[model samples]
Target: MKKVFLIICCAAALFSCRKLDQPNTREFTEEAYWRDAQDALDALTSCYENMSSDFYYFGNEALSDNAYVAGTGFSSVSLVAGGSYDPSNARVTAEWSYRYGAIRKCNIVLENIDKVPSMDETLKRRIIAEARFIRAYSYFELTDWFGDVPFFTTQISVDESKTISRTAQNTVLDFVLQELSEIRGDLPTNVQYAEKDRGRITRGAAIALSAKVQLKRGVWEEVKNECELLINSTENGTYSLLGTYANLFKVANEFNSEVILDLQYGGGRTFSTQRSFLPQTVALLRSVLVPTQDLVDDYIMLNGKAIREAGSGYNENDPYTNRDPRFEATILHHGSTITDFEGQVQTILTQPGSVPATNSVDDQGASPTGYYFQKHYDPTAPNYNSGLNLPIIRYADVLLMYAEAMNELNNLDADIWNKTVRATRVRAKFTDAGATEFPTGASQPQLREIVRRERRAELAFEGVRAFDIRRWKIADVVLNKPVRGIKVSSGAFNKDPNGYIIVEARRFEDPKHYLWPVPTFERDQNQNLGQNPDWQ
Candidate 1:
């Protein structure tokens, strides 16, 4: 949808106007603006544009165990991960404002779409559905990040905005679920979208996101039901695991069948994930998104057993070998080859005093974890601004969510295993009989760990890990300890047990850190918007 992006760019001024102040005859007014279909389309497109920011794509991973921020500057992520951030952190402020700002845009479209009398009835309904979907997605992010945020369905005056109080998260979720249910019939299925509109929201997208909302609320039965709707229904969209896991992220495979919802980035709009994740050797750019050993260790052996389990064939001395193939696809450890910007193969040497050490450059450019990300790398892109779409939700995530919800709601059966987890393993190229199939009679508890491990492996670095850990209530257990990295000491890779160096320590205080503090600025403006407990 290059045309959509272009329209978004040209209408940037209109999108940024947040105040719905009264319009005068001489000034450009809301009444004057929504005169036709183009106005509705532009307003809706601007909402989509707001969703394409880089923080949602890559920066959120640093908040979790999947990746570590190495730079020494004041990062809101480091502060939040350390449990020291208050409402004053700039990242928290920006995230809160950005999401609400987008919601305001969506609200504008919803309130004015009916004013366009000449617009096609079908197109108007679709536009309204799209606006509702975007608004629901925004509320989901806000409530998920900072619980009990101020909830509003329509644009309000400055006085009303200043007096708005936080709505309970469950109440907000109830409203979101209602919106999704009402609009599902209005949204087109993925297959129904014309070629130029392939990235627009579909019925499957709404259902998948609704299931995610249910999963977050710990409504296991509802999550199972919502996922089964997508899994069983073909009239809306057909989804399956792509043959190769690595190909799922390639630029050439944009909008592939496996993608349920993705932040579209093309038609002169793009992101800097390649620059953020690639090692200096490949892109000659700083590495801000370094994968952690904590995540690396989560990948089970190719034989489908934990590395520490008996007969798993794991070697601590040569730890990188005999690992799940996804480890190679997702991470770039030392001795890995990558195509440079000029198409030459280069080896990444993270060991100390090698031709280029892991800490070769300034602290800003180095990978403190001794590993760089390879999942979103686009070698053919001329530079950092690549047009690769990042998947917000995909079929594999749906399958894993289905499996987890089913195991929680009922017994873990072989049919569920084959349909969900086994299907994912087969896509990852785990063709061995033992690896592709779970042992029969695996208990519910056993299957829970298996599903959690699989989720970590398959969805690493996709910005979902932070939410996964938090919803599982394991953040305190996982985030309280030190984050580990491979050892690069005195010109060689250390193979001893101590080789795993402590990169940094993390913290997650109970109840308080479970949700981010309401921004200090927002609180200052609206006295009713009190800070989250423990932050005060």
Candidate 2:
């Protein structure tokens, strides 16, 4: 899978038209390519490979998720941290270059699909559908991130890529919806595909992404209806929640009823380690992503009340109890037990006398964020052998998306009854075993809040929170504050072994920070492509 990173680099290179002078057409149109089933399969896989590429997977995930925080000497942390970013520079360049490369791959498969005449009809259609879905998906991502991007359908000859200007965000989004709507039926439903097809795009994935796109465009009715169709399919045994919250993140529990779509990774030598970038890598003796105070405070109590709410049992100073149980499960801190996959607990002693304190982080790294992330940390795997499959789209997110759309559209139908509100209340009670109460009113905003909170608790640290905040127009309230660090005055702090809590004060970025600038190189190369406002 690490080799996929190189392909992504090639794609990035293609975006700048620098690699055009080389023999570029060979990979897209080799002599024997598009002749057989295996060729079609390989081409399809290549199309999907762009997703797992470092440029798309690591770079995109870090920017979208709060895991990467940019700071001085935090050169590697730019992915999540905002400081390392020049809103008008690096991010914009990467967006155009990577998406253009992805589009190229999609075009390669798409244009050649007809050439694979000997392949099975179903196989051929499926591969073509997957390519179209991915092409649309890539455009959706680009439109969301860059606001507007060139909608390239054909394999851009090096010259065209150099001259293409950004398309309007609306046009790109419309094109995404149109393509997804056209190819939705051709894609496979939620049925378990063959081993080779495990992570490929499915009809359900397309529908889910379409609903998300609709939601982003504020097309509440369409979003609500699309999600309802998927969520309500459970009556026919289509999709249902996994039995337990912990089971959702377990490697053995992957692709359960809860997952709509996921970026699957085999732990073979070829595949790169994704878990290494997550919290377990950091908390379990290596450094990776950390949880911020914003996340810590976002967890509402089990009673469906925010910690700041007057009636909730929240103590701002001793802020652990009476809060949501998920807070403990997802965030590792002073007293949380670090359990291995085999269920053996690793002692993380953060109190005085347990471990000697130091002034600076030495060997055992301190948690960059005061709280540690526990979203997908598998205890069974050895610390160095951490290899948990990351879930990109889960059933819980679909449920929340359904609720948000229904609330936005102000729909009170059976779909809403069966899918979002009732389904979520059941899951909420499942999390808090003693809680018997349910949400009473079904007002749009009320349901929206319920879904938002559910997303916060259920999807925390899968790197979705930051995007959710942006889509919901709540980033200013949630992320625009100076983040606090760990305050372990006398105990061993893992990321900071010396028990020294480093409080690096920061200023919240502005509205323009919401959108990244066109990379300097892209701006320099393409005169028609202008920088995002305030990027210069």
Candidate 3:
């Protein structure tokens, strides 16, 4: 978010060496490059390089009540979620710059792709559509977090970059939706791609991302229409909830049928986050972000009843048992066992006074919340090698988005619920009919809460919770409460009367917290880049 005058061209090494084992490297410039298809491909490939690190992806969960990151003084998430950060917060700045950096890469490709000599017309159109998809996605993220922001589709001069003012979010939204609509036809369908061409942008990705953007905007009809196109309109390509809930996040199942769009990582690319999430007892890894009990409690019983419900069969002493099947795949609590890369199953004890306590609950540099996240832990990524692909958009999310839209429109009947919620639950391997069946005669309000809760449970810790709460306008209700941890009999942490540990007291100011403050560093460089309200 600085004056980041576009140099426009840098070493091809600045791009990813290999796009998931494909050798792609070439330099591009508006003046010198753009000789052939390879040049356009190389420039476009750079746009895909900014998928971000695993820490940033998972650390975003800390922005909600679902997770907690210990105060690191410089950790932007802890500072912002803790409600003490200002305009200079690094995440604010980094999030802005990184996306704009991506948009810039895409702009280069779109503006110059036509210049390539003798490239296949269809391939060139696909490449253009791919570039536009990335640009649209970046802008969606920017406006999602920043509200209104500087908008551009072409590379700008340093001075132009400095003086351009923030555009209205409505205008940016229109542009994003328009871009996706225009590009969807030009992109290939997911099934149309060859085996080696997997992970590239496709018509399905565009529609999925468009539905998400529409959902955020509360355009229920548009969301339903777009999701229906992907779900029922076979022309877009086939997508379904595939494999078990646990294997969904495993390294071995990176690009399964459930995935619509994913960030590719492999071939010397490092996809490492387990070291910061696992306790030190797990091969000396340490927890920087830990799961809050709030997240754990969101998992309903296997009988489809909440823990506090009349017949959930939930035991406070044995809380992890008889819960949602997804709970075991997602959370690692005290007494949970993890198999090492060497095939050793080690039980991690997070109790207050566990032995060999270096990585136990409440140990220094350990999980402050006494819980760990087990999802997306890549045992195959030994030495942090490329071992996982992060799903940006998946089929489950599409179903949930469609359900939310239908519910909001008062059209969430048994048929829609069966297609979306039931399909998603069945894919997650829910056994009990009560857990998977529709609640007949439910009012719109009840249906709303059910859909929201279903979204939270199904998509937790996948970098979607923060956006969901924000779009639902419930951040004030959720983020303002203290993040609670597990049931602690006695510990350094403050506990409620029921003995659940209070991890941290959180704060969220409505309207102000809804949109983060524009980074002060950006304002410093470009005076036209003014601060958001309540931040000045």
Candidate 4:
């Protein structure tokens, strides 16, 4: 199912992004519009277009320990990685602006869908549900990053927007959860949707997204209940693990049972995640989004033991051997073979002193961390700008969420483990007895660590790693160190004790770094939108 949904071609439905201080122009001609079903659809497309940004999708991995942006080209990703971003940082402003922009579009749809006369009652309700889901998701992103944010549901006038103060984060959470729950049943399941509508938000997406929001808040019971609805329900659309984990990301294999929600991209209009992550040997290679050594080391051995564990067959000289299958699927290290931009199998040499600097670790468009990501590779696409849809919420994520909630609630046991973590590992091709079977008698803390690591390994580069680290409260620990790279001599860069290149030094200030400060750009327009702590 090639879901070609978002194209910013509808001018009447669209409003160019602006600082919130500007006049509210979305409603300038909305009464003339929203006059029919086609009009409603046009306006809704605008919501999806604003919601989807390829930058936030891959750039988020760069924000966490999972990946590194090579330079300042991606100021938000790089600066946030360095933990030096202030209220005026580009990301601080962009994230705020982009989210509210999407929300405003969705609000237009929700506020005017009732005027589309002669539309099918079912279709009308479904459209309303979809718009609300998008709005809830936008607010979720806002509260997740900025903590408390100004909340509104209606078309507020320009002057009214200036007087709005930040709502408590808890109040936003309540509305988000209630909205998802109420609208979930109004939307169709993935199986019920027609082929062309494959990428639209489904009932399963509403439920799964709600679970994720609850998980972030550490509401273990609610998270457990919501995730179980999908994981165990027969009436819900079929959502199971794809047997081959790597194929799940290929463009040909998208919209499979594993994907609950994906950012739909096809047709001529597409984004190039591969270009941003691939080496310069491939055409259009940006290579700014390089995998970090810390992420690679977290992949458990095939025997299901951490490499540092006793009797695990990890050797510093040959680090890539016998690691988790996910390691090979997600990371393209030195000497790895990949289908290049020209549709040829090419061996990549990303280490220092490689003959061609463009393909080596030295160039701007090459892997600065000496590792390119294999997960999003789509070499056959035109100019390497792949039309492959990116998974946002997948069934594997729901399983992991189930396991986490179970563990956090002290309810994890053999049965729950088998259904969640073990089931996910099985689908990832983990056949080893140690990996596929539960670690019997493991304490809650031990299970917590296991669940968290499995979640990271399963979902790396899919844009949720930063949220995971933050919610786990371990960002301060994992991010406050040298982001190590491939093993190299001490001349080109500083090396860790293990000869791994220390690519960049980073620090995370606890209490302050937990929530992003509201951007100064927004505050300058509306001082009622107060700032988070410790930001200049």
**The best candidate in terms of TM-score:** 3
lDDT of 3 by residue, 1-536 (tens): 33244432222232523343444454434567777776777677678876455656787888988888877522568888877788878887778878887887887778777778888999999989998998898899989999999988887777787788999998999999999999988998888988777889989998999899899989999999999998787799788788688888887887788899887777655656667777766646557778899888888898778888798899988899988888888888888888866678978788888886665665887787778887887777666454588887889999999999998999999899999988878877788987889988879998897788888888888889999899989899999989887787766778888888887788999889999888776777689878787887
| All candidates in order of TM-score, best leading | 3, 4, 1, 2
How close is every model to the real structure, measured as TM-score? 0.92, 0.82, 0.95, 0.94
Which parts of model 4 have CA positions greater than 4 angstroms off?
A: 1-28, 362-364
Q: Write the per-residue lDDT of candidate 2 for residues 79-190, one digit (tens) a residue.
A: 3244346733444555556665666777877876787666688878887888888788788877777787666676655456567778899998999998888887677766
- Give model 4's TM-score versus the native structure: 0.94
Q: Least accurate stretch of 10 residues (summed lDDT) in model 3?
A: 5-14
What is candidate 4's lDDT per residue for 201-225, written digit by digit as tens?
8889999999999999999999999
**Candidates 1 and 4 compared by TM-score, better number:** 4
Global CA lDDT computed for model 2: 0.60
Clashing pairs in 3: none
**Candidate 3 vs 4: which has more lDDT:** 4
